[model samples]
Target chain A: MTQDSRTNSIVINGLNDSAFKVRLNRNLEIIQSVLANPTTVIGLVIVILMLMMALLAPVITEPNMPDPYQMPRDWQAARSAPLTPGHVLGTTNRGGDVYYGVVWGARTSLKLSLIVVCLTVVLGVTIGSIAGIVGGKVDEVLMRIVDVFLSIPELIFALAIAAILGPSFTNIILALVVVFWVKYARIMRAQVIRIKQRDYVDAARIMGDSKIQIYLKDILPNSFSPVMVQATLDMGNIVLVGATLSFIGLSEAGIAEWGVLVSEGQAGISAGRWWASTFPGLMVFLWALAFNLVGDGLRDVLDPRTETKR
Target chain B: MSSADKTILSVKNVKKHFPIKEGVFQKVVGQVHAVDGVNFDIKEGETVGLVGESGCGKTTIGRCVAGLEALTEGNIYFDLPSDKIALLEDSEKQDDKKVSAEQIEEIGNSYDIGKIEGDLFNHYRRNCQMVFQDSFASLSPRQLVSDIVSRPLRVHNVCPENEVIPRTINLLEQVGLGAQHLYRFPHQFSGGQRQRISIARALALDPKLIVLDEPTSALDVSVQAQILNLLHDLQKKRGLAYLFITHNLSVIRHMADKIVVMYLGKVVEAGNTEDIFANPQHPYTKALLAASPDLQSEVTSGMAALDGAIPDPARPPQGCSFRTRCPVAQPECGWEVDDVVRRLEHKDSIFNFLKEVDQSDAFNAKFTFETEAAANQLMAAMKSDDIPDAMKKMVSKLNCDAEHVTVSFKPAKTVPLIACGNGSSARCVLVNK
Candidate 1:
């Protein structure tokens, strides 16, 4: 009886720890696994640096005034080479400051990718989850729509939508959102379908848990990892695609965007004024490559097949 | 430890058919009769073992009981009063019973698992819980042990928020776990430990009945015994009724008070555990018993191993579903045209030459072959030793004219389960005698 009482006290002490600690521990474990790989760490570093650059663009470079996103003109340093005093990283033939453009380009790309990713993820996950959970005729109709979206090549499809909507950064974002959400919808739908069949979901249902509760607790958490992996991969791909759209003159001229800077710099390339285009072009490549690396690492860590080992 | 009078659950002629869809439109072409017309009862504190091979619909029956799958037909009355259960049983036994149809309907509407809604359904859910076969699949990987075990308590508001933790701890302790295991995920535990966690979760709501769907099948032999013993002790302490479903006869023999032996989608034999073991009336039950290894029996003759594969559930045989595989199959055990086709379809020499089959019904068919010789060969094959004597004996007509060979079997009725004394029943023609 005394032994039982002693154990009971221990139980009480253990139970005092909040559920938050459990969640924290689980999340910490996943983070640890994701950070274990060297390439992921490198990608993470590049992503962090890029994010910092974007966040601190105003502090690093003086705002262009009226509209900070529009590149500041420097007529005196037009076509100037890199490292020239007051004209660092040179200037475009049209007098756009390349330094200001590179720094602010990060901010533009970040804003564009973040908005598109959030919108597409929300839209895709919602539609996919509804299709998966409801199933039958509703599933059929929704999936057919997803199929139509998925049938065309993503770039070509986005190009068509952007072209139709008229050339602008916002239109490009809208086009990216349309082209991107379908893959996520397909992924999330498949994941939900698979995870819903799991015994835990059925167990939850058997416990008289409402359909919404079952979806939230059993189905959603288990199925969200793959969506996350896809989201991370798309984070980089979106920027690359956005830049490509802007490169072809889809975006507003003289804006502080990497693709537009590259487009402006391309005119002076044969005259050896490559700094203007090369720097912004390099930023795009690094941004895409970094996310791709991180996404692959996340896949390796979060893939359900490998999850059992942990 | 079972109190013989009060019934906890009454499964009455339950059937569950899953549609097999085809084409892009998903048109329903056929149905897989997973559980067809199963009947049984679990009294308070009793353990009724549902034993069958895989695909015999034992799991489907368990799912039906757990309210996982909506029933295609019939009602599973939960926690009906003893008198009502007796009245229902009486009505089943005798068509001209005194109990009115409206009274049965009232009882079903209130107590049926499928039909009840609102507070009544919640009450049933609280009373009934299930421990799945795969512990890994049953417990949420993302949920902590405390959360997994305490979820039911919290959902039902069985206790205050603060009290949930202590109650969950108590439950864990009951299942042989400790407070240290509270914050750990499911993957942190061994197979046996995970199963213990599952049991703790099942016991959280103090359920009156727990459906054990092959709970120990995924564990090691030693672990299986430990889990079974824990379950037994828990049942004895809580007076919980259990519907233990498994294919392992040894496990069932050790745990079950009453045994229901199923073949295909129907129960072939059901009785008190000892009675079914000592005197298995159905050939399927006898074959099952002989197949299962027994320590007490020194000699392993292995004579009763059944031959032939289970027939397709979509097109289940006309009469006895097990007659196709039963060693002691009789002439009266339904023989149909499908059986002949099934037997000869693999024989390339005869089946490859067959052009078309004009099946008028299950028992009668005309085979139009590519050549007259093939038709004559089929006729010869029917009379040959390759066909079972019972099936050959049941054939009433066999004629070959040119490329057309007509074969007909004696029409047979669907076999019904007959009472074979001592609170037991068997679904075989021999049982009627």
Candidate 2:
């Protein structure tokens, strides 16, 4: 880099440092609160390990793909059972390694959740903020529209959308995003509506702020708390929705998704071949459970009401 | 442009009435007369204090002037100059008087506040800022003091973005907040400090007319004194005008050069603060001084208070609004049949039983009674001296035909605030009597 470029970077760094220190301090305060609770720490560790497992999927597993219809040629090699070297948790009817499937399933689940969450939070907050700030007949109409979506069962809506969109992991995420955004929009809209009436908004108005300026500067930033808490909690629900869609056969056409593995295990179970479904089912349960625990623990920490409670 | 000669803002007979919505369909029932015909002029480089009880619409008047609320009637004349003030005064002649939007922008750049456009509104906004009552809720907690104070400067392009923090720190210092406080959030500061930051933000625009709307009503007395003194010093240095609104008599006495005492929604008494304080002419003004706990007489005598509660603003008492609560209510104080019933109804069951009252402007009522004895009792009460004598005397006829007592009160015109005893305005019949 040029010397001038380095100087410009330094100037920008100083600006960022000064601008966001308070936000950083508040984030650190949340991190410290999580550290204060041991169960929360354990949940955090589980999440960290899950993240690692998802990231290291290719490195740990065989590069080759498993043949879904391949027979277990060597019975003992297939029935080597859990705790045996290389054959941990035994093998499926297709002779696929259970450990490899677990690693790969973790990757698919995490990636799917991250995509759904990004879509839900971004689209949801924007829609909610507009509905909230432009309050009047528009607010009433938008809220009723949100109310209709929120009233529908999450499972039914996901299923109906997935059915129409056809079975694929991408389609499942799209369906879940559609179903999940309503909650963020509702929480955020309510929060914005409440905060927009506060005296700060009035002060902003008296300061000659236009409606757009008030919405961006006064309403949205102050209304961030409820949306933040909802977002954290909504992660668990989003993951669950993804897994449920996969279980109902809306996963990538033939790839081994956790839910599809569970379905495949159920098909293999009567014949006493339970490894395929059981391992993937445990991965899905553990991921969802970890997210929920972390979300609940973060909620107890990030929530302003809880601070007041203490 | 001369300091001592300019009339900064002229408020004409301003009236603001809020509509009352009632019933299943939510029909526009009637207007709640929040502010009815108020007029006051705020001079350049002077503090004009607006004092009244909580519901007297002092804040409403401030809001109307500040353009927070729309005026239901009347005009607000801003002395923003022909450049700023001249164009807004044009309610007609748009095309002929038309300057291009760009030329209007140039006008904004060249003229005083009353003469400008977009930039002038920005200038007017910066010049005529307001400080709110509740310091606790006024500042946004999530924001840093630097950001909050620098917000106005940024919005109006008062300074370059890089110069913002330095300017903000300077403003913070000006308002008693310092360098150590700039990076802190609103919750990190105490109430007084937060209010100082709010003042700093208001001052960031370098406004000439700061509307301190009960700025000290929500602070500790000592803190209030500090803010008051800061405001005093700032005004002295900047030569600013302030429209100080408060219910606190003592604070208004110390701060205002001219005081406007409001009752119901009208200015009942207005003059130099010394004149109003030394010899409060209006009976309502006397009652306010009597009621102010801080200014109790040293005689240890029971301070004379108005007898009843404030008359309902929805249907404010006719003739004189203060008559219902006046220590000296006269008979011709527009003592209507309703007032006679209101006065007697509370004392006995004679009023408690009557289902409905059908009143007419003809000073008569159709007889509708649950029982005849109740009607007779009402007629008897109207004749008694326990009620106003003028009510008993001016009441031309009382004919109790049956269960309905058709009584007629002498029709009296609504008394205007007329010049009365020793340079005072009295809105009562007896003042002329």
* DockQ, each predicted model: 0.61, 0.39
* Candidate 2 CAPRI category: acceptable
Estimated TM-score for each candidate: 0.97, 0.83
State which docking tier applies to candidate 1: medium
Tens digits of per-residue lDDT for model 2, B328-427: 6677676666676667757767776576667886356655677888778777777676687656766777787677777777777666666655554545
**In model 1, what is the error at residue B184, expressed in angstroms?**
0.3
Clashing pairs in 1: none
Estimate the lDDT of model 1.
Answer: 0.90
- In order of listing, the candidates' clash counts read 0, 13
For residues A142-255, what per-residue lDDT tens digits would candidate 2 score against the true structure? 778888998899999999999999987788888999998888888788788778777788878778888898878878777777667676666666767777887788876335
What's the lDDT for all of these models? 0.90, 0.74
What number of backbone clashes does candidate 1 have, counting pairs of residues 3 or more apart or in separate chains? 0
Error of 1 at A60 (Å): 0.9
**lDDT score for residue A63 of model 2:** 44
Q: Kindly list the per-residue Cα lDDT of model 1 for residues B1-433, writing each as its tens digit.
A: 6766588898999999999999989999999988889999899999999998899999999999999989999889998887887788788777567988898888888999999999999999999999999988898888899889989998889987756788888999999998788888899999999999999988988999999999999999999999999999999999999999999888998999999998888888999998888778888887887877672263233456777788889988989989888777889888999988777766668877889989999989999999988988898888877689999999999999999999999999989999998779999999857
RMSD of 2: 6.1
